[model samples]
Target: MSNPYSEQLSRLMAEYRETQRAMVEAQQRLRSLSVTETAPRRVVSVTVGHGGRVEDIKFPTAAYKRMPPTELASALLDAIAAAQRRAVDEAAEVMAPHMPAGVDARALLSGDVEASSFEVPQSGVSDILRDLMSDPGK
Candidate 1:
């Protein structure tokens, strides 16, 4: 006995397979992308791969020699954070066109797409200034 619904189910399954293939390809491309960011005064720099992995880090010779261990550690942390933020921004930008309308790319990259769509949050000037003034350690 042939079921009429069988054909429709097969077609749906084929479509799902194609979509999954495309998603895998997109993830591969994203994994190859890289972003680099440097801290203020060129004291520290970091590079991050598309998979959110840190690829490289560099510190100025003078900065490395002059700063105490704690300060150096703090600077490195700050540089890494800056690089991560830049990497996330880059990922969002690359994924924007590929994403569905109203989808948030950052959220998608963060594995938060299930929770919410992509929406870039705006940072105020005052907020930036306050962060700049605050101690990096704290």
Candidate 2:
């Protein structure tokens, strides 16, 4: 007779391995992520890398020099913020499928919540193992 429990376990294990592989791929893509944003009238441009780390900035034109110091600063800040927001949005989209249902990838990346708060549920694992061992044919 076929062992249904064994078949189920094998299927689950295969799924787990596939999920791990996909997550690794997603992480690799995120690591290489970069985004650039330019402020109005090209006052400033900023490039951000993974996790929104500022990688580069350029005035792009003489317009920044003509602006007041405060305005220039504001333009730089705005460009950097826009770049970071784009990076976070792209990252969230890439990671959404790997996250559990109802988990907010954007909120997590934006630092709105602790990663520990999204800990994977542990209930099914133990229950499945117990059932498998208790009944090989179940």
Candidate 3:
């Protein structure tokens, strides 16, 4: 007779394979993602990848000629920041469904979601310790 658990095992295997395939596809999409943003006056455009690496920048030569160097630098930085934000937002969207419940995918990417970073306030800890020391019998 066939094993009773065989059917469940087969179904689970299929689901695992599907999840792997989906992860691969999502990774490819993220790698190929490029967010382009323009400055307030459309004087500069910046393109950044999903990892926030600068991929390209474009500013008209005529505009550059008339713009102050400080303004140009600020515009470049603003455009890059805008593009990075867009990339992070898109990555968060893509990663959310795959992440565990209650996990912030964006925070994890920024190295801010680690469990070790969680801390109880020192004052709270001290209060608890004081209470324990004062009421050892309880």
Question: At residue 7, what lDDT does model 1 achieve?
Answer: 54
- Cα lDDT of model 1 by residue, 1-138, tens digit: 664345545765797798788778777767887877777667777888876689998875566777688887887888787777777877787677667667878877777667443355544444544654684442
Error of 2 at 33 (Å): 0.9
Candidate 3 displacement at residue 74 in angstroms: 1.4
- Write the candidate numbers in order of decreasing lDDT: 2, 3, 1
Candidate 1 ranges with C-alpha deviation above 4 Å: 1-25, 111-138
**Model 3, which residues run further than 4 Å from truth?**
115-138
Candidate with top TM-score is 2
In candidate 1 the C-alpha lDDT for residue 128 amounts to 41
lDDT of each: 0.72, 0.90, 0.80
Model 1 / residue 104 / CA error / Å: 1.1
Top of the candidates by lDDT: 2
Model 2 lDDT per residue over 45-92, tens place: 899999999999987889987999998998899899999999999999
lDDT of 3 by residue, 1-138 (tens): 764345545765797799999899889989988999988767888999979999999874457667889988988998898899889889888888887666788887766778566453444435545665797664
lDDT of 2: 0.90
